[model samples]
Target: MRGATAWSSPIDPMAAEFQVPVYFDYLATFSWALSGAIVALRKRCDIVGVFVLALLTSVGGSILRDGIFLQRTPPVLTDPVYLPLITLATLLIALLHQHIIHLQVVDKLVSTIDAIGTPAFAVVGMQLALDAGIPLPGVILVGAVSSVGGGVLRDVIVREIPFILQAGQFFALVVLLACIVFLVLTLALQVATVHAAWATIGLFFVVRTLTIRYNWQTRPLLRDEDH
Candidate 1:
């Protein structure tokens, strides 16, 4: 991707693109927090644990992203959107827990939400890193790590290997692909940032869908116990 320098142009395409892919960041947080709450509740965790887990899962990524960028304290903390959303999703899961279990639709919802959430992260992470003037490789690494950072932390705290490492899914690949997408479009095509964001979101999700559909995963050779 063409690097956005001080003299690149008065217009900033990357800023525009940031807005487009950002919605997915919101959705991913909501779903991740909700999912954690559901799991915690299912395991009979206490009320405080439920809330803590929910917040960590949902807003964790953004907090890390914003901090790295030296942006304002995250809106997820001050804004009203996340708290209520987490609360509602958690309560609903708690109330409907029994009925939802063993329901194929629920399983599908979980899987779809998880699959969709992954790529949404890739765009957000890559964009943030690029905006911060990080190198592409660093941006890619940061993107992948930020994209799934919260989930990985949540799973570890709750005692589960994150989906990225298992489940035959190309979790990190999604973020890396997203980083490449942004770099290529911004640098090579010099496409406006917002348009690039739309493309990134579309492509990332499509790739993630294929990865899930085909059970695409890192090679088993990478899974040795000693590694």
Candidate 2:
């Protein structure tokens, strides 16, 4: 108790209308839409499918976050810019489909974009949860959902397993770690919210990029006898 960090005074709900920076939100939205559109193209989807996937992957997480947890209008609906951003992503994929598919850097480009968007959305969701006065566990949950919920929807629609549910790179795990680190920094260490968010995002990006570079993977809890 002697060494415990003092909890900050309660935040006023009215004053708690926290916002993720416009640039961060829009950049992440576009990156995710681009990733989704690429996947749609790889699956041989038509232009309509590209748009559908782009829209879902760009906004599905925020939809789940607001509708289920925050219980408010999702920013994709309230903000005028989000849809246009997704449309731009779709158009880019539409016009450059052949070039993108043939580029040697496509994999690396998608990985880089994913690394950026994942932490960005996680931080955004974590901030929203903190402003809403949710419990710490709920905050982590919101962050993970906001990071991967869109990909889950896209995968399901395409009849493939969701990345979060699969034993692959540390996607949801990284998000959870990021959210926990943010809470520890802001709540326990008393760091400023913006600084803590940036630190967490940086940490997540570094760890995620390293894992991808090294082919670090999660193994099955129970291995199959055939293997």
Candidate 3:
């Protein structure tokens, strides 16, 4: 007990640390894992390769994150439930890849999931860093990295342009908005972070869906060649 300030349990909403963040992290990580499986099989990888890609894509960034924060082995590896869940997700995607590709809502699903992942991961990262007593800006930086880390790794592994860099997309924009909402509500305004987190989720879903529906995009830098 450090003076009067004992570490609060995660069950307390106001507590700085949350235990189930790993579970949420799993959801955030699934897209990359599934994408790995899809791209691997598409590239004609063997069974070993598929699972290898799955494991790497799902947990690589988390491993790197833990290493960065000096946590050994990564929580996803130490935790028993996460691997099975990721395995199930990858298997489902592998088996149903055909159906997945054909879904008219597939684009929407990716957008929705990426939206959820941003706030979920970012808020969790922020809380973790805060619990460890890091400064706010550092917390924000780490949070942003956690929010998009796996997806960036996944895209690079699959030899595709990272979704964040792809023009005409809302991928990183969702995460950026999420991070801002988290930092503002939790740090600056001293409001309920959980509610603020969900607000970001709703905000991302609405804005992303609109962007997709309206074919929205920020135009590239102009050149004078045509003019």
Candidate 4:
């Protein structure tokens, strides 16, 4: 498939066709890495742990996508720019985390990054799946995995419950919805892929941010007798 091989090298951000999506993927990687690094610091992990989480959180989804679905070399290993970019993000968080931790906006910043990165990765994964001729259901699954697989892995590594499994807040649900919308726009309505991707990313980011701002949450199936 076209996307299966596109990650071997950095593409020109200004190039037409796949430009915006590719660039968005890079930005999403850095955002995820930064978020992971911050979590590592908060968990009192050493530098190695910080780097490990940062790198994994940035590319774990892609790895899962390629390994399990595409059966290709994961971009995290082949793409020259991915590792260095993740390293830069990790370094920034590792060095400035102490100062940033005291800031009132830190939580907001993390939410903002996650909000942006989630849809960015999701749409990109959807596009790749389409290019690979994957069926609609499989495309949606790939997009969802590309969106939240990293966070799930990160939480597992830290011995915490995965955010998607937690009752509070919409996480993977947002990604699933975004993927569905993108597919509807591009497939059903026949919209251009790039335009649909951007629209999905913007809409997802806004909706995700609002969920965080309003503290929107899901309830578990069973009621707590004590409560």
Q: For each candidate in the order shown, give its overall lDDT on alpha carbons.
A: 0.69, 0.82, 0.65, 0.81
Which scores better on lDDT, 2 or 4?
2
Top model number, TM-score? 2
Scored by lDDT, model 2 comes in at 0.82
- Greater TM-score among 1 and 4 belongs to 4
* Candidate 1 structure quality by residue, lDDT tens digits, 71-93: 53555776567788888777777
The whole-model C-alpha lDDT of candidate 4 against the native structure comes to: 0.81
Instruction: Give a tens-digit lDDT track for model 3, residues 1-227.
Output: 01122224322322433433445666767765666676677777776667767777667656655567625356676668667867886678777877877675865566577656666766776666666556667677767676677667767877888767766655566667767776787667877766766676677767767777787776546646756
Q: Indicate the residue-level lDDT of 138 in model 1.
A: 73
| Candidate 4 local lDDT, 1-227, one digit each (tens) | 24444445433223322634566678889888888888888889899999999988989998998778866668888768899998898788877887997786876776787788888888777776766667789989998998888989999999998988878887778888899999899889988778888899899988887887898988887779747
| Superior candidate under lDDT, 1 versus 2 | 2
Candidate 3's error at 103, in angstroms?
3.2
Off by over 4 Å in 4: 1-19
Lowest summed lDDT across 10 adjacent residues in model 2 is found at: 1-10
TM-score of 3: 0.77
- For model 2, what is the alpha-carbon lDDT of residue 101? 85
